[model samples]
Target chain A: MITIELNGQQQPLPTGSTVSDLLSTIGSDGKSVAVLVNQQIIRPENRPTLMLQEGDQVELLIFAGGG
Target chain B: MDLLQLGSHSFSSRLILGTGKFSNAAVMLQAVRASGAQLVTVALRRFNREQAEDDLFGPLSTIEGVTLMPNTSGASTAAEAVRAAHISRELSGSAFIKVEIHPNPQHLMPDPIETFEAARILAKEGFLVMPYITADPVLAKRLEEVGCAAVMPLGSAIGSGQGLANAAMIELIIRESSIPVIVDAGLRSPSEAAHAMEMGCGAVLVNSAVAVAGNPPEMAEAFAEAVAAGRKAFRAGLMQKSGSAIATSPLTAFLGATL
Candidate 1:
């Protein structure tokens, strides 16, 4: 198991857990978010293939109304 | 009326709405529908699941003929703005992005160098870059050369409600820009929006003036009518202003004498 920061909260995930797994674990479709792993944005197509490691910081950003 | 063209896209409405400062998402949607704005701007931020599950996009999607124009509001540098643009594209599924790089939180004045840099990169990446910039004629032309879809120049400081403190500079930008010139920020009323159109701006993006008004929906409607009226006035051609007051009636007709 490796610890990762998910949306500012530290959580432990099994070794070799990809972004897709993270989304599934959180009950999200990954459709409404822009995920960044270690400060690099992970495209939706690559989310399933990109694996998270120990101490990896992940950020999921959502779109809000703006001016 | 001719269509308002920005890059390859054309829109009938010359007023672009900003979704910030509304009382709520529901109220925002109502005002947007009332405004008749085809393109609306939204910000990209960390997805907060705790906030009411009613995401802004879900409600916004119900309004037909509306396109999402996400803005990089919090980005302070060109790289950050570029990253935000990519994120916005992936999230919003729209090619239109508003590049707003304001490092200074006090005034929220967009950084010109950063804006130009971001516009250049985003334009090459096949994104329609609309950069918010100061009312500088030269920078407006530069952004055009960089392949920006449009130039959004400030009428005054952001959210100031001062109403075109830089009207002459904005006019100069409008005159020099080959692409669309959208006057963004610092417009407080429909009359100010009309004034921007009369100065030959392609469109005006207003937020606070309507969102913070006594009645957001009604204010939106007022702005819509004002933009249409201003565009019509521009198309009709405005009379030249002169130092001497020329009588509407022929000077000789009223006096029964020739000047």
Candidate 2:
């Protein structure tokens, strides 16, 4: 298992897990969420092939209410 | 129709509603429908699985004729705001971005320097930038020159419900700006929104005023009506002020005395 920073929190993921696996582990369908890995946007197509590495700073963003 | 033109997009409704501070998502959605606002503002947040219901993209999109203008609220710098704009464009598939860069939470006053920088960059990048700013004519004109679709000057403070505290300065902004001058904050009631419109503001962006009302939907409808009436009054032109009373009826005395 490797530790990856998810939304500023440390999370352990299986070695060589793709971004899709991470989304699955977190129960996210990746439909309405924007995923960023190491400050780079991880597109939906790239999420399936891109593997997560140790200390990868992953940030998920969603639209919320604001003025 | 006097459409509210922002860049290439046009909207019949001038009431811009902010998707915040509502009691619940359901109520917020209902208020949105009642407001008749074609242009709505939203914000980006870190995804929280525990509070997934807070996500408004899908729910807000369900409303007909509503266009999303996602705001860069949390960003404190120009670079952060630009980055947020890119991400929001990707998710929302819209070119409208509200460059809101207020570093201090206490006052929530926009930093003119940073906002100017962000608006310049975003406008150059082909995004329709709507910058939230102070009631400064110089700053508002600067933003317009930088290709901003509109300048949203606060009436007072955010959520204060002060109702046009800086009316004098806002009037100056409206006078000098070629782009739309929108009153974004510090409004408490529909009457305030109407007053802002009557002062020649292209539109008014309201959130706390309707969100905290007794009945959010009913208040939203009232604001919609007020905005329409004010816009019509402005277009028709208001009567000028007079120093003394001007008699509407004929002044000639004919009943009992000679003319």
Candidate 3:
């Protein structure tokens, strides 16, 4: 198992985990979430192919009401 | 009136709505419909799995004719704002971005340098960048030169309801800017929206004025009408102001005198 930071929280995941796997593990739809791995944005189409490295930082963003 | 054009997109309504501070999604939807706003602004924040079900994307999707404009609020630096803009595009599927960089929490005044930097970056990235700025004509022109789609100058501080405290400066910005000038923030009522439109602004974006009203939908309708009236008035050409009142009838040749 390897540790990665998800939304500033550390989590353990199996080796060779892709961003898609992370979404499945977290039960996120991946449709409404914008994922950033190590401050680099992962486009929705590219998420499946991109693998998450150990100690990688990830942030998920969503729409909120604002003026 | 002609359509409101920003970048490659054209919208029918001149009033842009901000989707914030509403009590709920239902009211926000009603307000958007009643306001006749073709574009609306939203913010991006950390997504929580537990709150995913109640996320705003679903209800906002239901409102027809409204395109989402994601704002990079709470970002103090250009890089942060750019990152937020990219994330916003991914989430909303829209290239429209509102570059809002307010480092100071208390004042919430947009940082001009950061905003300009972000605008340049976002514009180069092929995003339709609309920066929120102070009523500075020089900066407005600078932003336009950077290929920004529009310039949104604050009428006053955000949510202050002060109603165009910098009207003269804003007028200058509108006159100097090549792109659309959208008067945003600090508008207290429909009359203020009308006033902004009357000043030849391409559009007016209001949030607290409508969302915090006693009845949001009703207020939205009022704003829509006011904006339309203002645009019509502007197009028709308002009579110039004069120091002395002029008589409707001729002074030398009155009704009986002419006869």
Candidate 4:
């Protein structure tokens, strides 16, 4: 099992849990949103099939309109 | 053209540019340069991790004589806006804060109450506050009361580029504001920007229009020239409104009529 911390929330996931797997678990629509891993932005193209490692930190950001 | 004094910086160009929606960093840089904009708006956020080197901040930082007006674009409430302002001040080392508080994402309108609250707090804290608001005259006055450097009333919904949606309110704001009134957002073309300037707006902020143009650099240059011309015309004073054409008769003709 790998410890996945999402937006400061800690959770345990099965080993080899890819970013796709995490998104499926989290129910993200994958539109107008950005994903970050360990303080690094993960682009959409790389979000799928990217395996997770131990103690991985993830953040999902959704952009909205503002002046 | 009037030069607006905001905080410690003085801006001669009335065209405030936003650093977003660029096709590339090079295009953004070129467009900014061509725009002759002394003040550029940038969104405050973490660095993108995909690129080896973050080109956005670096190029913008290197732009000589351009002041970075970092905006609290993501903040939803007064507290969040204040926090973002604090973080921006720390990162940019500037006291200028563009206080933006919008809870809704669809219309992107300012929450007048929250914006006013944040502005009051930020003003008391000695930060130069420029609140982005709707073209509401009363809210403009409130912002002014709170010591905002300028009131940026939106010309229309942000990123809409649908042109001025609240012309009457904008006119009222321009008429009533003691400090500079900058028309920000929803300006689609050079004509719209020029029209706002002609309406006595101290400045206008444009982003999506130029950034999303086919040739951003060329578009930037066009906007710069258009703004300059508009300001010049405004200073020169435009012609008076007339319902119908009248024959021009000199005052000397009055003496002949009397005779």
Best-matching candidate per lDDT: 2
- Give TM-scores of the second chain, every candidate: 0.96, 0.98, 0.95, 0.92
lDDT of all predictions: 0.91, 0.94, 0.90, 0.79
Give candidate 1 regions above 4 Å deviation. A14-16, A48-50, B52-54, B250-259
lDDT of 2 by residue, A1-67 (tens): 9999999999999999999999999898888889999999888889999999999999999999998
Which regions of candidate 2 are displaced past 4 Å? none
TM-scores, all candidates, are: 0.93, 0.97, 0.93, 0.77
Question: Per-candidate RMSD vs. true structure?
Answer: 2.5, 1.3, 2.3, 8.2
lDDT for each residue of candidate 1 in B1-259, tens digit (9 for 90 to 100): 5889988899999999999989888889999999999999999877766773545777887899999999999999999999899988988889999999999999999999999999999999999999999999999999999899999999999899999999998888877878989999999999999999988999999999999999999999999999999999999999888999777765556555544
Q: Give one digit per residue, the lDDT tens place, for model 1 in A1-67.
A: 9999988999899999999999888777887778999888889899999999999999988878789
Identify the superior model by TM-score, candidate 2 or candidate 4.
Answer: 2
Q: What's the true lDDT of residue B176 in model 2? A: 92
Which residue runs does candidate 4 get wrong by more than 4 Å?
A1-67, B52-55, B248-259
| Residue B186 in model 4: lDDT | 91
The Cα RMSD across the true interface for model 3 is 1.4
Model 2: per-residue Cα lDDT over B1-259, one tens digit each: 7999999898899999998999999999999999999989999999998998999998999999999999999999999999999999888889999999999999999999999999999999999999999999999999999899999999999999999999999999999989899999999998999999999999999999999999999999999999999999999999999999999999776876853
- Top candidate by DockQ: 2
lDDT of 3 by residue, B182-239 (tens): 9999999999999999999999999999999999999999999999999999888989
Model 4 has a DockQ score of 0.06
CAPRI band of model 2?
high
